[model samples]
Target: MNPVLGQVPVYNAYGSVPALPLGWVENYTPTGQPYWFNTITNQSSWVYPMMTSKKIPGTNWLFVLTHDGYEFYYDRDSKTSVWEQPEELKEAMQELKKLEEEEKLKKEEEEKQKALEEEEEAKKALEEEEENKKRVLEEEKEQARQEVKRIKLDQAVDNAEDVEATEMTEEDIMWQLQQMAEEEVGMDREEEEEVQEEAQKEEEIKQVEKKPELSEQECIEKFYQLLKENNISPFAVYSVELPKLMLDPRFSLVPHNKQKNLFNKYCHELGEQIKKEKSQNTKKPENEFKELLESKVTTKMYWDDFRRKFKNDPRFKALSVTREKEALFKEHIRNNLNKKNPIEDYKNLLRHVKEIQKGIRWRDAKKLLEKYDVYHAIEDKDKREDLFRDYLDEL
Candidate 1:
């Protein structure tokens, strides 16, 4: 009935035998249709749709005479093979095609998984490289900072101010703070300056003399002078030193056992001396004061200053001064050593902390692993296949 599966007419020698299944026909698939024509057996079959070419016909086909297990035909013109038509075997052929498709799909999925894994590995490697770069940069920056300290130490500013002293003063920084507050609260300069004057005076005295040599007002003037010269912030100075002070010397006085009348009447005398100096040279007053202060703060001054601030404290008195000195030396050494990568940094030490605060550790890796899906597997036949690593996009 259908030309694709032609009817065979059973007849003697010359022509036609009519029957079920036995047939010979040229394939006649329309354009845009997919078919594989086996003219050998005068039969054609469909593979995946829209695959290959259509219509194979008008040629002699091959045959196997020895067994005839499954009939076949060959075309001398096209040198092609075709399967023989057998109506009863159609179901078996369909099953074979289904199995073939399954195999193909399985292979394709495996390839996709492999590609995915490769991409994930590449991505991880890039991330690791970037992290290493960042770590190296951080170490280099730390080294530079240490080198700077080494240079400063070698120069040995013994006759000079300590590192903190060369920095901002309490008065200079406080002035800026006061300025900000005044602007924020919309206050007049006269009121703010007046409030600041007393406070500043008291502060200056404690810093300059740190003993009975200077009074509160004189301290204020000295502080003011030094701040102006260095163009430093007074608040910043106080911020740096407040830890060492048993009490803020300007606002509150803690009369140490070693020093009494810690505030002195040096402001007017120093002011006059400054005025005379100015008459001789036009150099700025604050600059002169800054230089003088820096030159005067010797190592002896550091110990003396500390003693003055803490001498009255019962707690410090409880500790032996000899013991304190040893402790201080040990602390300095440890600080220097801490500038390098410690033994902990060499190992991947995991802490539960999500932050890298004072140390370098391997907790960051564990965290990344936990947050991402790493490996996956698929089962096919008797084999278990690793589906590869999935990518982690931005969280």
Candidate 2:
């Protein structure tokens, strides 16, 4: 009797494993047994012989071969190694072979089941995709059919008239069309001329009324009211304990942008300032300034009173250019001088002395500049004075 397998250590099967893994070894030895190999040092050392095996189909034995060494004997009848083999290995070997075969069969069945499931899923998915494609195509065909029907219906319209048999001459029809176009163009042109003429009249009226000078005290009061509405706080009293209020962010007279809103906030701030001043004045004995300032916004009497309040005051002192010969000579002097860079009171007295020396009346010089656009024409100071002096002398 010959035995191909032994009750050997598990390490004896490592030669059957293929190659190295990156960081792990293949651990395919049977459980609960260990094996050892002899090192390259001794000649009489016995080793678990390396063998390769395959089934000779429909036989009770498996064929065996050594791993390139010729020490082992081959037995063709039993299909096992004959040398250095034991009798106790037959049952263990048979059990191991049966377990391996059962595992392989189970794995093959699992793979076949997995493949069948995958194929079933793929078939169901394909069927669903085909159904969706059919539905989309059906909807597209239905929409195209409806569109074609609508076009045909429009072409074969209801309440349409039949063609007339009478022939139309091209020359007469063209003449009629030309006459109609001329009449329409003429009507449009006349309407356009009328609109333009009306617009021109309105523009002329606006142009004539465009005087930069302050027209009335009502306008002046409105200007002050507008400033107060924009929340422009006046300068405060130099106090110690009170929180200093900042000027409102809204009071640029000639602002870079947003003049309208700034004007509105300016009025609001000034109104608040007036209210504060009024509250302080309520404690004082009868004051006329607060009363006049608190007067009605619509009152013309307030303007007259305001005019009277400043009348004959030194603030309105007959300035350097005061000449009484012209009716608005005082106003003329006030108008021509830039309000921002006003002449000092002492400087006005000197200019008055110089004007008296020129022998041309001072009022006449102020009037000449105020009435006409003299600023554009006048370049030379000396020449202007000479011409102005001549005009005043003639006056």
Task: Tell me the whole-model lDDT of each prediction, alpha carbons only.
Answer: 0.42, 0.45
Which regions of candidate 2 deviate over 4 angstroms?
Answer: 1-91, 118-122, 149-395
Candidate 2: 10-residue stretch with minimal lDDT? 237-246
Model 2 lDDT tens row, 316-367: 3333232321223223334443332232322333344344444546466555
Q: Residue 222 of model 2: what lDDT? A: 51
Model 1 RMSD in angstroms: 48.1
Q: How close is candidate 1 to the true structure, as a TM-score?
A: 0.21
Q: Which candidate leads the pack in lDDT?
A: 2
Error of 2 at 302 (Å): 99
Q: Please give each candidate's TM-score.
A: 0.21, 0.20
